[model samples]
Target: MKTKAVRMYGLDDLRLETFDLPEMKEDEILVKVISDSICMSTYKAVKQGKNHKRVPQDVDTNPIIVGHEMAGVIVKVGKKYEGQFLPGQKFSLQPALNYKGSPFSPGYSYPYFGGNATYNIIPPEVMELGCLLVYDGDSYFGASLGEPMSCIIGGYHANYHTVTGKYEHIMGTKAGGDLIIMGGAGPMGLGAVDYALAIDNRPKRVVVADISDDRLKRAARFITPERAKAAGVELIYVNTAAYDDPIAHLMSLTGDKGYDDVFVYAPVKVLVEEGDKLLAKDGCMNFFAGPTDHQFNAPINLYHVHYSNTHIMGSTGGNTDDLKEALYMAANHLINPSVMLTHIGGIDATIDAIMDLPNIPGGKKLIYNHIDMPLTAIEDFGKLGENDPLFKALHERVEKHNGLWNAEAEAYLLKYFDAEA
Candidate 1:
């Protein structure tokens, strides 16, 4: 079969091309990828290429597929997985396949099985590790977003608080405790906010602090303080850059007791230190961002760490269980992963999008694998509508959902712009 995909050859070398796919073995499954969401980790892999821990050194000779957060339909199920998986079933997968303690994952490691392709082969290890997930969501984008949302869920689950005079630590964020997400107005941070509000052990107060007012305003538009209040949580958005003393201003909101949970969403050193200062006794600071620099370091208050039981930790990606939780929550309407989306594109846009992800200045960039369109922002749909009827229709649909992407928009997109059509 012939499949179109974005393949990374070496450092800063990515190509969008059509290639012949080898026949699937009995232990493999064939799939037609529908949607893929671009991730920062992909950008890092592109920059580091073979030097990246997950990317193999032979990528220059045998290029690997460039995406991971993907959703699609099973086109053919091999005999080995006949009953477990069938053709036409909607699916998503946890790309962090730690099979046999190997660092190899789908997006960065695989040559024939990555997300940025029109078709992909599901390898045996994926199914063996139970990373291949069946998604029953209405929108393919929702399934595509499941991977990122899982990371957010994993961060929440990884947070630990010490019990009074106990040697062991309690897993997960504190219940009914004050929580703060530093630099939280971005895409992943927004997901963290949504999960924090929707979780069973909800925080008493949720504070999101960012330097950019525009991003904060956009985040508030989606997950408002009113909405959080209705969920029995107090949500506040603060533009820390506007304050003369940002830490003091944020601490004042917490009644000077400090936050029980502090999530640093940006890898900035200042943000990490600020989060450390805001941590209360037994507070757990989660460094949710992945820094490009290998030697990235931030100083924390050691005094508080020893005397006040404050500590810090970080998570790279979620496990299979976390991915399942994300899918279930999205399907059950407990969390709206659409809030993370800001732009949409086709397979043709994947390369540029991944290459310039940091400068894109928005949330998730979603790519439809079987279309031919450039990366375009949701906010520009209305403007682009003046030139194209498809954009016009998309604009109307997204506007109906308060400028957010929806299943209706996705269906319309496929109907009009499907490459098969």
Candidate 2:
């Protein structure tokens, strides 16, 4: 089958290319992708070219399809797997193709098809691993968001306490704990916010700290005071330049106790610095965002790890359990994922999207498989459906009643003019 994908040819260059998909094996399932989302990993891998783990430096496989976050309906299930996953079932593909002797995983060496194209072939091993999650939604682009969200879930499940030798320290987001999401308005940071809010039990407060006033305001639009209050959680938006005294502001927010959990999502070097200052006693600081080469270093804070019982850890990739949980959370309306998506386009737009990462509106970028359909993000900036009275009424209600975040809020959020600011 001929399918289109955004293929990375060389350093900092991506182009839409058509490729012939291999014949489906007995254990494999062929799926027609409905939607996909551009992730930070994709941006970093495409931009840095040789720096990332997934992007092979040698480029032995030239023009590699560079996407993993995607969703689709099963089009053709292998005859051997007829009863397992039937055709037309809505599902999202999990992209952690590990080959290092993990149980039931198709190793990385094999050509594992991702979700960027119109179709993807899922190997029998992946199906057996039970990583694919099925859910009902209008577009698969939103479903693709699950892959990243699942990775966040897995990151939280990691034993960060063990890494820092804080044997007595218990890690992960806990009820009544303070969470400071540094760089909290960016896409991954916003994801961390969604995950932080979906803690089953609410955290004491979820603080989104960033240097840009626009981003903090953007964070406010999604996580409104009423929304947070309804969820039994407090949402605080703070502005703190990387060089300025952000720690003092964070300290003030926590009454000088500092935060219990901090998610480092971007500009990780700054995160390392603020981490030493803002982490509460026995706090867990997670490097959720992967840093670029030469852009990261282990903080020399042995005392904080030993005396203060600070825990440090990092994570990448989605697991089966995390995918399942993410799907459930998205379907049940626990996350309001639509709030995190900011850009929507097609395969050509995806190429442009990856290139525009540095300037991308600080939210998720979605690529629809059916490029012809109009981009319909559940955001406030775009005009509501003309004939759909329900959508129009909802838009008005959000703007008027839910004054916390609406069209005006979206405009405020999207304005990020001052880079030096």
Candidate 3:
């Protein structure tokens, strides 16, 4: 079948083109792509192209579609997996397949398997590896947000504590401990916040630190103190830049004992250093941001790592189990990952939106399949609602829950932004 997609040809070269997809094998499934959230990883892939570890060396000859955080409906099912899945069933994929210990993944490696297209082919490995998931939720945007949420979950799970005598470390963050989330107002940071708050043994106090007062204020709108209190968590928002001594100010908030856990969400070196400085004895510092340059290095507190029992670590894309947990939590309304979405638009807006993703200055950017609307921020719905009837209706759905995005809003978007409308 012919489809339109943003194909990455080479380094810094991405083109939107119409092409015929290769016929699927008897074991493959065809999916009509619905919603895809632009991830920073996609931008990295587009800029690196063939040089990217998972991308094919002959990427020019085999231009791959370039998105991973996506969801859709199964339009065609193969005989091999017919009984397990059926047409019209909504689904989202765990893009980090890690098949047979291979670093290669769908959007980064597979030519016809990425999410930035109108259609995608689910290879047998995805089904065999149990990466294809049936999404029963109302919002495909929430479903697509699952991948990013899992990544934060994976990092949270990876946090460890050293076993004093055994020379080994215990995994998972300490229950009811002080935690710090640096750059806590960004999309990924907000996701980390949601996951941090909803988990079964939630943090006692979570200090969300950022440089931007505006971003911090906006974040508070969703992760309110009341909401955090309801979750049995004490939410603290702090503008790190407001202090004459930022590290000292953060320590003061934790009563100078420093934080038990610190997760740095930015690739900035200063943030990494600051995160280490705030580590308490036996603290765990998780560098959640993925840097662009392969050789990038941040100065870590080796002294604290050994003496104070403070350990530092980082987690990449989540594992299969993490994806499952994220989906389960989202489907059950246990965590509101929709707080991470600040913008929504049509699939046609994907190319430009993705190219400028680094500068978009918002949370996740969601796209409805086959729509042609420009990128619209959820925050802008109110102002736009004052004039346009379409935005006015959208404002109602988006504003209903204190400016949070929801399935009803997404459903309205899909219906209103379709070709006929």
Per-residue lDDT for 1-421 in model 3, tens only? 9877878888888877788888988899999888888888888888777888999898898888888988988989989998899898888889887789998887788888888888888899999999999988767877898999999999999998777679787688878899999988998888888888888867899999998988998999888889899889989999988889999988988899998889989888899989989999999999888887668787887887778988888988788789889988999998888889899888678888988998988789987756778899888998999999999998998778789889887778777866321
Worst 10 residues of 3 by lDDT: 412-421
Give me the runs in candidate 1 sitting further than 4 Å from their true place.
419-421
Q: How accurate is candidate 3 locally (lDDT)?
A: 0.86
For candidate 2, the per-residue lDDT at 185 reads 85
How would you order the candidates by lDDT, starting with the best? 1, 3, 2
Q: Considering every candidate listed, which one attains the maximal lDDT?
A: 1
Give candidate 2 misplaced runs (Cα > 4 Å).
48-62, 100-112, 137-139, 159-171, 242-244, 298-300, 372-421
**Reference-based TM-score of each model:** 0.98, 0.81, 0.95
Displacement of the residue 4 alpha carbon in candidate 3, Å: 2.3
Cα lDDT tens digits for candidate 1, 1-421 = 9999999999999999999999999999999999999988899899999999999989999999989999999999889999999888889999988889999998899999999999999899999988889998888999999999999999999999877867898899999999999999998989999999899999999999998989999999999999999999999999998989999999999899999999998889999999999999899999989887889998889999999989989987888899999999998889989999999999899988998888997999999999989999999999999999999999999999989999899999998865431
- What are the runs in model 3 whose C-alpha is more than 4 Å off? 163-168, 418-421
Please tell me which model should have the higher TM-score, number 1 or number 3: 1
Q: Model 1 — TM-score against the truth?
A: 0.98
Q: Over the stretch 1-421, how does candidate 2's per-residue lDDT look in tens digits?
A: 8777666666787767777888888888988776677776677776666554566555445456677777778889888788878888888766675534442221111243665676778877677656666777544445778887887788677634333454454545766878888877876677777777678745888898888988777777766767777777888887777536677778888889987777777756867778667888777877777666665685647798788877776777668778888888876767656566665455657777777777755577777655532333445432653676534654554456333223332222223211010
TM-score of 3: 0.95
Name the lDDT value of residue 51 in candidate 3. 81
